[model samples]
Target: MTPPSPATSAPTPTLLWIDASAGIAGDMLLGALVDAGAALDDLQSAVDAVIPGSVRLAAHGVTRAGLRATKVEVEVLVDDPPHRTWTTIRDLLVAADLAEPVRARALAAFARLAEAEGRVHGIPPEDVHFHEVGALDAIADVVGSCAGVEALGVTDAVVSPIALGSGTVTAHHGVLPVPAPAALELSRGWDVLAGGRGELATPTGLALATSLAGACGPLPALRPDRTGIGAGTRDTPGRANVVRVVLGTPTRGTTDAPVVVPADAGPGGTPERAVVLETNVDDLDPRVWPDVLERLLAAGAWDAWLTPIVMKKGRPAHTLHVLCGPEQATALGAVVLAHTSTLGLRVTSVVRDVLDRAWVAVEVDGGTVRVKVGHRAGRVVQATPEFGDVAALAADRGVPVRQVLAQAQAAATAAGVVQGAPWDPVDGGPAPA
Candidate 1:
């Protein structure tokens, strides 16, 4: 038989599944990347570019519970650098001459950390002081790991339930419980295990995992191509002190194929494949519906809503429906199952046809407001101010909401974004006169 032509076969999408069952830390994650074929020299060079000559990186082969792994060590050479704030770190990362993707990933990971720290300390994220995590070693670990991720070309990431470990850990702020306040804050809404002794998941590890992974669950069906074990420093008895990363190609379902709608379709819209998950509940407290809707949206539901209905025996009920991308179906479904009283849910694949829309920022009264433009056949069909931005501007300026809306629409019209007449403030509506 003649060999299949390479051009005929589609390239498989790469996925990196992290097994944090033993827990995760920044060094452990970097070590995992090193073992999985990310070039240590490249990682070192990237870290050097970001943090200068403040730290040295080393990767050593080791075994955790008879399983081979890689251990990464970061040696800080600088003598007690000033405690940096979140703003300082963000400025440094943004100014560094790094690849755009690497810079973005590093900044996102740090932003997650900053947000968690800010929440824990009751302060703004920009003003949050980084104590131990602001050190050169932490910087190297975070930036180097992100660089490695970029180098490996791993596009999708999934994390297993993290083992949080138990007990107490002392920080610069004082004696904090195991899993620390920052770690706990980061792990909120994430699957976490509190078994085992001492700290398993650090704040850095939680931040990186939560920031990078789009979904959290058991390993999806995939054909494993490579595996790497990252060893942790502590050796708790009866368990392997390592995090495992598996790289593979998904064996189930289509690989994110875009469903293009025909030009003759209604409204010349582009339709994308999505899944609709739904359930009906008649017994839950009505006060919790708002929170449920909010959680579903936060958990990656593109849109979620509740509809009033009549259940058996004329009992009033609600039908909760969530729309999301196909990849998030399972995770979001789990969210519904966990948060609601329904024992089961209905999932159906759907195609959502939408107009070609773009967001453009318009300056109004000192602050920038975003306006959404919907186009059909390359011509603007509808232009509207984002209500959230309009409301914020209105509150800040102590003006009517309609006035802010008019100003934003007028700004959009002035920029030639919309073809028709602008909204008139005097008439409080779109203008033709």
Candidate 2:
């Protein structure tokens, strides 16, 4: 029998892939956006809205490693500007009259920067002084890049493994190692590579990349409509000091339409493509499985489980299954190889159709418990209390786990919590009363 033909319809959302082979910086990204066709006037307008004529942005045509690119320069108009704190920056962004999406992206990037700085300085994000990155120029770079991205109408972003340079860099805190403390903090979970001999990825650059990139890996199979090259200020002899941005649509081969599971069935999941990694282990002690699973989860595996199987010579074995975003497959696979006895693993790309879901917190016995609400076709269908939250509440209140779970579900229903509501799991935290 012949195979079915691939779907002819275009993918619903578009993807923008960033090639950081040369390295990435805030100005570089902004320049790339302008080169890719974002209007400098519009980007400047957005920035001006936030800072009110404190800076000017310009993009110049340049060559790096013999490749033509755009180099963005930020000219600060203010003399002796105040070094802004995270709170100050956040307020400025929030009060800006920019487009909602652009404002949100810009604020998120700054928030990530603040978080990284806080981690390095041992302070809360609100209190962290931005130092060099808090200046008018850096602020303009971040805001302009974000506004440019929004102007391009990109729905998702994919990034190559970052190239972090070696050696040391001078900062307000004195001499810092290459990749810097803030860069290191920003790159905590994602893939990073070392190249060159200077500071390649700055803290602001890292924050913008991490904030926009939904996945990180090689450029996906795409039909490119436009490509932009953003050049860095310094020219390295052997390498291109530039960041590449490719705008395109993912190539969708013949595949079945996503199967939308009912909300009552379980947690709704991502609608994008995912990877399934499998391996068999027969020699490792059973006692080691728990630790291995924990490590995999911490490493960003979406879900992991083990299945019993019979191997050759009547030996009992276990098959480990790991499901994760395609961008995360390589990193999670490394964990499996290093922590397990398996010599090889199998990987396959799969499509997942998930019901939309949201996390809400409910008050029970003076403590809060989180509930996972799943929605299908824009209606709530499943409401399940998070086991971890239920267990903690049960322990705290000295009540049966079932009692806590029941009460939480009831509270969620009363609050009119449903799918399709505006709730960000990361930022919303436990919902407040």
- Specify the poorest-scoring 10-residue window by lDDT in model 1: 1-10
Q: Write the per-residue lDDT of candidate 2 for residues 157-191, one digit (tens) a residue.
A: 88889988899999887898998988899998888
lDDT of 1 by residue, 165-232 (tens): 89998778888898888998999888999868889899888877876676788887788887888899
Give per-residue lDDT, candidate 1, residue 368.
72
Q: Tell me model 1's lDDT, rounded to 2 decimals.
A: 0.77
True-structure Cα RMSD, model 1: 15.9
Q: Report clash pairs, candidate 2.
A: 6-254
Taken over the whole model, the C-alpha lDDT of each candidate is 0.77, 0.77
Query: Each model's TM-score, in the order given?
Result: 0.59, 0.59
**Of the candidates shown, which would achieve the greatest lDDT relative to the real structure?**
1
